[model samples]
Target: MGVKITGIGSYIPSEIAKNEHFGKHHFYNEDGTRFGHENDVIIEKFKAITGISERRYLPKTLVTSDIASFAAENALKNASLNKEELDYIIVAHNYGDVNYDSVQSDTVPSIATRVKHNLKIEKPTCVAYDVLFGCPGWIEGMIQANAFIKSGIAKKCLVIGAESLSRVVDPHDRDSMIYSDGAGAAIVEKSSEEGGILSHYSATFAFEEAHFIYFGESNNLELKDTRRYIKMYGRKIYEFALSNVPDAMKTCLDQSGISVDEVKMIFIHQANEKMDEAIVNRFYKLYDRTPPKDSMPMSIDKLGNSSVATIPTLYDLVLNNELKGYSVKENDVVIFASVGAGMNINAIVYRI
Candidate 1:
């Protein structure tokens, strides 16, 4: 028997921010030049390199819970389960609804209340909490949910990975141009089956290679400064992901008694196109097998790296015929791998 993912859903804010919109930033050079301004060059240089055609963002009036509520409701409906049956709710977010000023505030409780009210769910015994990590958050949440159920501590779990990254984006920085806002949710239930979450491997290298992905002042007064936005060492991160994730993937498959050659598909955190290609190429070299010619899937192009939400959102897109002809079925081993800003990497195998 194994824990199974019954349903999955994703929510992108209605507001769409495009790459061309960055043209309005007044940091251009005398020759009408700006770093990463050329569309094609920018696309080719970055890992997830497609110009983010459009991305969703929560309006000023909305918060993280609102985005989460939408995703959770859709996930529950897709799973054909009632919200009342949810034994636990796990929210994975690096940025919360309230700004840093309200870190001491009861933001978790308030967000929980709003989720319950919006979804019309009965108060759950385990109603509140947040998990802070880098991009590997959603995969970590799933691993935790599976553990909770396997321990008989929960019957069903709603695992949500949501982020309103626009709040942390430095409008003037070209690196931030690819970031947008979104949320994703999954409904997991315990089943006496052979598939579900087969194995998970996670590791964090806390070395100070290039640690600053997102930063804010320890004092509230620094909120107004542009430094408060996310800053990424793109080259270092790309190198880290390329070198680390392939080993992590091999470790997961090795522990699961499955060879990488046997797996049918791989779903990586949709960080960028170039990164995706690099990882996929590595897989090809390591296994000496081609990836079924179109099996590598990505959503970073349009979704603009929805952080933790990227994987699940890409999963939904695949399941909903967005990726036509690529079908996931029983006994097929699918791998989920991610590397987040904390120099953290998570790789898991799931059989469906």
Candidate 2:
């Protein structure tokens, strides 16, 4: 038996937070020192580096689980599968659900359970859970689903990556502008078809990188509050990703027995444009070739970094032909890769 994504979907929030929107906000250094450059200059530099001009923000009335369910419903429809037949529901995220007006996150009932509840699935055997492996959580969830299906524990699984990073960001931190909110999901199931998940790799480098991405107080220390928000060492993450991610992708592709020349596309996490390009370039260099034009389709320009939601969402967009100039056909080989908190990294070599 092989594991394949039979269907996919994504929820791109209607509300757009343009870079221009941050113009009025005060950005400060980690030490709470005001930036020497004005907000315009900072935003311009940010756009140049991250390639994010605007990002989607979840509406105030909805929560992470809500969007996750939306994406799940769409995927179910796309697959033409009955919801009651699903054997597992996996939701990947970092923060649970943070209200628009509050910093507290709600995680009592797992997001998967909430999604199952939202879908009104009554099957008691449809086990639901959540994975918090940082931005790679979604791909990790897919790996687990593949394992379950291969082991005869499941026939079908709904794996979702959803996050409201906007709800967890510190306005005082410039990195806050890099975050957004969104959800993406896929229906993975057993298939008799020839091509499916061929190989995968995962690693956690927590020895010294454990806290590279963590929660910390606002950059504006003048507030004097204990509430923490999403924080990270940007330079550290960039260097770490460049040094490690390409090797991980190469390892995954090699395990699949697919040569570098056969890869049609690579759905990498939409963390930063420059960082992603660097990783792909390094991966190609591993085989003594440069990356092919249009090999990487990026949504980061408009979606920002929505934590776990990036890859699946981008895949969904490309599949739907909403992402121009990128398309995948039957029997195509592709790679899915991501790096994030836990200082974790993972890659999946898949055949379409």
Candidate 1 stretches with Cα past 4 Å from truth are 27-51, 98-114, 209-212, 216-227
Model 1, CA-based lDDT: 0.76
lDDT score at residue 142, model 1, on the 0-100 scale: 90
Model 2 global lDDT (CA atoms, 0 to 1): 0.95
Residue lDDT tens for model 1, 1-352: 6999999998977787766666555332223345535654553444345435656666877777888889999999899997888988888777677452333223656554666667877665856556676989989989889999999999899988888787776554556667878888999999888888989999888867537465633122323643455667777888888888888888888899887766888889878777777887886667776667657776776678778888888888787878766667778889999888787889889997
Give the lDDT of residue 132 in candidate 2: 95
The lDDT leader among the candidates is 2
Query: How many pairs collide in each candidate, listed in order?
Result: 9, 0
lDDT digits (tens) for residues 1-352 of candidate 2 = 5789999999999999999999999989999899899999999999999999999999999999999999999999999999999999999999998888886999979999999999999999999999999999999999999999999999999999999999989999999999999999999999998888999999999999999999999999899777899999999999999999999999999988999999999999999999999999999999999998899999999999998999999999998899999999889899999999999999999998
Using TM-score as the measure, the top candidate is 2
Model 2 misplaced stretches (Cα beyond 4 Å): none
Model 2 clash pairs are none
